[model samples]
Target: KAVICETPLGCFGQTICYDLRFPHLYRKLSQAGAQILVVPAAFTKKTGEAHWHVLNRARAIENGAFVVAPCAVGKVEGGGESYGYSLIINPWGEILADAGSDSGLINANIDLEEVNSARMRIPSLRHDKSFQF
Candidate 1:
């Protein structure tokens, strides 16, 4: 389903946390002309430590879209620590800035031009999707 909705800036498809596991969804969104994917997440300490950074970078690198994820930090009630590596990743799998285990705002200087260049150098997006099943 091709969907579009609104954000503070404009319209955005409101996909939840589980959707991050599906890279194809991101590809579809990017192919549909999305430049940025905003992921507002509150992942638990266990899962976020395991896959957060890699997945965030992978999706951006794959689709040439900037992935901006702001995550909740600190210990929650009932003795749980939220996984707090809030980050902004570029299309080159490079972390622009990351806030680790602290509650704060991270400002990054992002250039849209880098996305095209990173994609061109590797060209992985065009090479993905080959399947054996």
Candidate 2:
């Protein structure tokens, strides 16, 4: 399912941790005018250790949109653990800020112009063509 939110800045979409693995969902959101994507998750230590950062960065790079993923780092109530590494990735797949294992604040100067620049250079969104046999 897709849910697009309108903020004063622009339109944004949000997804859970598991949803980040699906590209089509993000594609649909971006297609529908989502300039930013939020992934708020309490990823398990097992999975979070392996794929958290890469997935977030990949999503930003592939969609040419900002990805703001905040992952819970500590262990949960049910004996589950969280891998803390909240990230703010830019449209160019650069990590603007990262919250490390400990509780800390991350700040970055985000310029929306960069989104336009990346999309202008590689307009993949406009070039997708679907075909089936």
Candidate 3:
């Protein structure tokens, strides 16, 4: 992963919709020096509306990393409507941009430098380790 660190973290961490439910993976990636995560999802409106944005933000805040989720909007042929709320959240739980209730590219011009700064300010990423209790 560090080999392509200059390529931008957002471009590489794109995962399926269900992957967001797993926070440990993000934690490991963050500890390995990942600063941002990308999730491309096509969740059913019923579920997306209930949990999508909140979960996305939660993951960002918990792992102290940025999250960019680009979700499919509109109704699919065989499925119900998809909740379209693409988001770009910062480490401090700030929503840089949110794509709410519509379909289009929600562009966010974030300072990639913030990731390191945020980590330094909080310094949580540098403190992770396995523990037994």
Candidate 4:
């Protein structure tokens, strides 16, 4: 299930690490009027390297919402290392900030208005159709 919280910044959609793989969750959040989707993840280095950026970008592009992903870095307690490439992407799927493989704070100036702008430009959300086979 997807949860949404209203904040001073905008309506934020929350999801944890592995949940990022599911697109339906993001669509639910976006349809519920989320302007920003927040993903706090501790993804394995291998999987992160392969799918992190692309998945995050796809979520932002498809939903016309900003994606704020803060990923863990360094070795985990049990074993393997965590990938640390935190990213702040806009609704247009442009990466505004990246925290490259290190534990540090990354910031980006986000304009909430851009959410509306991107949605207006591509209006895919308004065109959604459901069919069963």
Candidate with better TM-score, 1 vs 3: 3
- In candidate 2, stretches whose alpha carbon ends up further than 4 angstroms from where it belongs are none
lDDT of 4: 0.95
Best by TM-score: 4
Model 1: CA > 4 A from native:
1-14, 126-132
Each candidate structure's count of clashing pairs: 1, 1, 0, 0
> How does each model score on lDDT?
0.77, 0.86, 0.77, 0.95
Cα shift from native, residue 121, model 4 (Å)? 0.6
Question: Per-residue CA lDDT of candidate 2, range 1-133, in tens?
Answer: 7999998877788898889999989888888888889899988888888899889999998888999888888868869889888999999999999998876777777777777888888798888678899
TM-score of every model?
0.81, 0.93, 0.84, 0.97
Q: Could you tell which candidate, 3 or 4, scores higher by lDDT?
A: 4
How much lDDT does candidate 2 score? 0.86
Q: For model 3, how does the per-residue alpha-carbon lDDT over 1-133 read when each residue is reduced to its tens digit?
A: 2221436434234456888898777777777666777778988889998899888998888777788898888989976888888899988778999888799878777776777677778776667677899
Q: Name every residue pair that clashes in candidate 4.
A: none
lDDT tens readout by residue for model 1, 2-41: 4555455433434556678988888777766665677778
TM-score of candidate 2 versus the correct structure, residues matched by position: 0.93
What value does the lDDT take at residue 128 in candidate 2?
A: 67
Q: Residue 105 in model 4: shift from native, Å? A: 0.3
Instruction: Candidate 2: give the clashing pairs.
Output: 73-84
